[model samples]
Target: MALSLDTIGPDTKNTAKGRLEPAMPPENRLEMPTQSLGRWSASQERKPVVDRSRWRTYLARLFVFGGGLILTGYGTYEMYQVVSVSRTTVLQWLLVALFTVNFSWIAVAFTSALLGFFALLSQSRGRGPLPTTLSCRTAIVMPVYNEQTSRTYAALEAIHESVEATGLGAHFDYFILSDTTDPEAWIAEERAFLALRQRLGPQARFFYRHREKNHHRKAGNIADFVMRWGGHYEHMLVLDADSLMTGECIVRLAAAMEADPDAGIIQSLPLIINRNTLFARLQQFAARVTGPVIAMGLSVWMGRDGNYWGHNAIIRTRAFADQAGLPDLKGRPPFGGHILSHDFVEAALLRRAGWDVYMLADLDGSYEESPPSLIDLSARDRRWCQGNLQHMRVIGAKGLKLPTRQHFATGIMSYLASPFWLFQLIVGIALVLQTTYIRPEYFARDFRLYPIWPRFDPERALALFALTMGILLAPKIFGTLLMLLRGHERRASGGGIRVVLSSLIEIILSALLAPILMLIQSGSVFQILLGRDTGWQPQRRDDGSIPLRDIVRRHRWHTVLGLLSGISAFMIATSLFLWMSPTILGLLLAIPLSWLSGQLGAGLALKRLGLLRTPEEFRPPAIAIRANELQQRNATFGYDDQDGLLSLYCDPELRERHVEMLSPTSRRKRGEIETDRALAEAKLGDAETIEDVLAWLKPKERIAILKDPALLTRLVGLKSGTSAIKAAE
Candidate 1:
């Protein structure tokens, strides 16, 4: 009666030729979930009322956005006036347009940050008190690809323990949904799942499933679960491999959902943690400091029409199933095909169906990690760039809310803005070149009182540049001031002076890294435009150091481009060279910058110096500490290098567990050719031992053999002593 992994046993009642059959009924099988096969009707759902506060939010946005546009327009007019004193040619007009576009991007950011600062300052108190126990079942699902089994399972175990501590553990179930492709990784996940079950004991409400085909990747993985077991649970909490949430936060989210019937999804703000690399540490500091202010502003403006960040959020299972069934887009990849960035689109769909999506900005104890280096970050950015660009197709989808379209537009612009900035720089250089080199045709067109001189008022230009820099850096200034105002946070960050010093260092580093990111993102945009598709790959989470040669290979082009641009600017004018010095310097040092970004020693040295210290790093949260402890405990059991077939052949219990977890395939039509099964059978017949099987079979053949029950039977009957072992050697 005790709940355990083994209790969910194989079908003992049914057998075919003495082989055990799957225990579950056909409808309840792992592969087949009862699906509601039809388009969800919007007319049946009650429409959501517009929030009254939206009027005030709209007014605020208009004042801020309109003021920014007016300011940028004035700046553009001044630049035009400066160019008009000289020959007003096509080149000058192009420069004006570029400047306006680039300036508007930053102007909007500045105003948003200013609004965010006010919102943070005016935030109200906590969400009253916790409710007494009474709720529907919630499943906490962690969908994984090829990842380190120890870390992922350890995080899950820690989370399970945290939730159990709250006395609400019985109301929740845990699932490890794997889409792992690598055979080794797949076996490792099974081993880890077993180990986790043992550690938690028999009654632990934990389950694991590995798909034969990844299908539509992650979206498909979740959909498979929803269609199958989703009928049992009222709500589902989604977590990434690296995600960690405290029990209090989880309980609060569930209680809030129960209180609001119209709520479809609720998102929590996840802060970065456990990062040691220099780049990662800097990112952690910035995210911890400035992320809250921006989130508060967004929450105030968006209200119930917010966004989902894919993880660290909970969704109403029925609402998501009925409303968020995504259809494939038309045509080929990089534009058409399956949705890569599915979370945003899901949120839009839910909203379009009259369900409210909200974000809890003030909620704490939610945590995640960042990539360790600039190169790693850029690699991840490449996938995101492609995904965001694909949203142009979805932005025009029928019945989507206006704010949802804006969200899609914002995602698209986050990548496009980089190329815009780069183009602006190129155009500015061209304008300077024309002014300094080409002679003004004073008498060619219309008669003039004086010969036109291509020139700018240097003092006014310098003042304008100063204003732009101030606007761009104002968010950092406000974030720092806010931290200093709070007594506990200031102390946790190593005092006001240290916090101030850290902010300055962060600013300088961010400035140097900006141009490098600009170039990387611009290349990503170019590649996507050229029809290059970025395939899904697991992210590297751990950090130590990267090789110097690898850094050089990745950033060599950036360095070369920097040198060429720097030399060209200097040759044109000292002022132009001076103006471009920051970008040039960042580019010229790209290799070294990237190298230092991944250096653990450099980051630790800063920690020793009391720089870039966050509250979490100083005090260390309970959930984070527990995760590390579990990870270390799990690390002692190392995985075997032998293939899946070899490992399963050696262990009877493992083979049984694996067979029990597989989807029932006995109902396949007669004479249907299973390529894997046929090839596996052919290869197994000629094999003399386990070693022969390993040597003769390819990776695909091995996977096929492992999945087929008949092939596994032959594998288990093979000779298993010193002769077979020696053959393997």
Candidate 2:
């Protein structure tokens, strides 16, 4: 388990006994140039056998889109008949347009789920046998931000151990790429890195790098890795901080890549796991039960032109470096600058270069965690909404494939749908108010045989409503039936009866949560359209309840709006009130529902009742089990709980090691007037003791000092007064 310090640590030529050593692996450089978005040339590699797949893809697309069009047309005609009974009005046309948009959205999904249903019935999970050995090396890179060191490092350790167990560990190496802006989190990452190395032994290929500046966020962190050290490996399997995969799955992905030389990216469908909150468990259940069907449909129809979900996907290093380099768009935040949703763009670029991108839906063992609560989900969705809206600028880029463009449209619509739904509701409400209260215009400028009435045939309206509900709910039914029909899947999801019951519970909960999320997403879209940006924030992984006041503050307006909508609907008609009850009740319960979404006790109660039980909960994966065990052991270090500057000042060894790890730099450029660094230098010069420096330094100043060896040394020279912060204390 031991190795010479010379290979992985700082130079020890003049080192004292008490000095700490650097905990970094040796450098292996690779050049990955930023790609040009304006022009692209297809790769000259041998293409895969795709004649049959091409036909299948065309049929699938035609079936889904054509069927959707047919459904939309029928629904539109029915609405036209209902409204054009006497004469059509402006409000009626608006209603029809909104209805068409909303109906088409679900119609497409309904048709696709039908495709998925049939595909599932006949699809095979067999991928033959795993390759005996690998011909190329892969770098499993996990890009991290300001994250909990213990949880991330523990997950990494588990993944590494799982890979090693397969005896193909020699072909793989792991890297922890950090873009942490938090100084304490940065140091904690280093400490955890060292601990992991010691535990895994020198035979394990583990590396760590922390960026001084988080320029492009995660995309930048990974780009830094690719530019610096990507050449040594044939493929890079990207992992998020919460991602974990089995050794078998890892090897199989590598094998798939090796087998398909045309493949640029191979994405594994990662299911949700290790979640406890009511919201999270609901997500976990839906993903485990229904995700596979949807993914299978996507994979089948998408063929080799599939999209990436950022992480838990393996990419050809050469292909990605050559074609997938992202460019900042023109303009400002929200719609401009560096691409926020880089995964879709990267896939498009790769496909544009004539490389295949595939999503392996049947590949089990890829796992990721979800945001634990409604508030947490809303926070994450805001960022996604902003990112997806930015894709509008990329959709028309030259040389992009049709499917690639469709992917962009789909992403953009996912966020925009919320606002569209809200607008549709408003339009419907306006129509209802006009019918109930507004004076009808009996006279027209032009000669008319009959006067228009702002009313719909109740029978036709009711029939259309039934059809819309069927289209909307078909996918869930398809997924549930598919699960029930399969003995293994049915058993894995609890018994058939329990599975049905759980599906119903998830459906009901989702219905209640939909209106709330709709409002949240609608607001996000509005803000983005107004040129407001949503900055990246770390997701809350634990099932921690938000403050009651915060929940009330967030949902108060939604509650009031719901009440008003209900009152108006009831006044309009009893039928209207009944029709709108789901939406009204959902918005009315937003605050309390949000509160319960994060409650551990409520989620556990459901679990005890055998509801929302994922197969992973029934038979936990070995890697997941190992990860939990290591998380407990690693968390005992409590590195994140310490103050970075104070810990270094009190512990000389850590200070020395911190200095040794900084990239060798000359003096600051003469013309440069960096505010933070300059301020840090001035404060350190004036400080007489450690406490003075601690009190004087801002976060930016602290980061500047932490990155500069000279400033660190100056801080180390400060006096340790009685009031000085100490690591022991």
| TM, every model | 0.91, 0.94
Q: List model 1 lDDT by residue over 431-478, tens digit each.
A: 789779978666755688666656776777787788778988988888
Assess candidate 2 and give its TM-score to the true structure: 0.94
Off by over 4 Å in 1: 1-45, 49-53, 124-128, 447-453, 640-643, 665-686, 695-698, 720-729
Per-residue lDDT of model 2, residues 363-431, tens digit only: 888999999899999999999999999999999887889999999999999988898899888888888
lDDT of 2 at 576: 76
lDDT for model 1 comes to: 0.81
Backbone clash pairs for candidate 1 read 3-202, 11-23
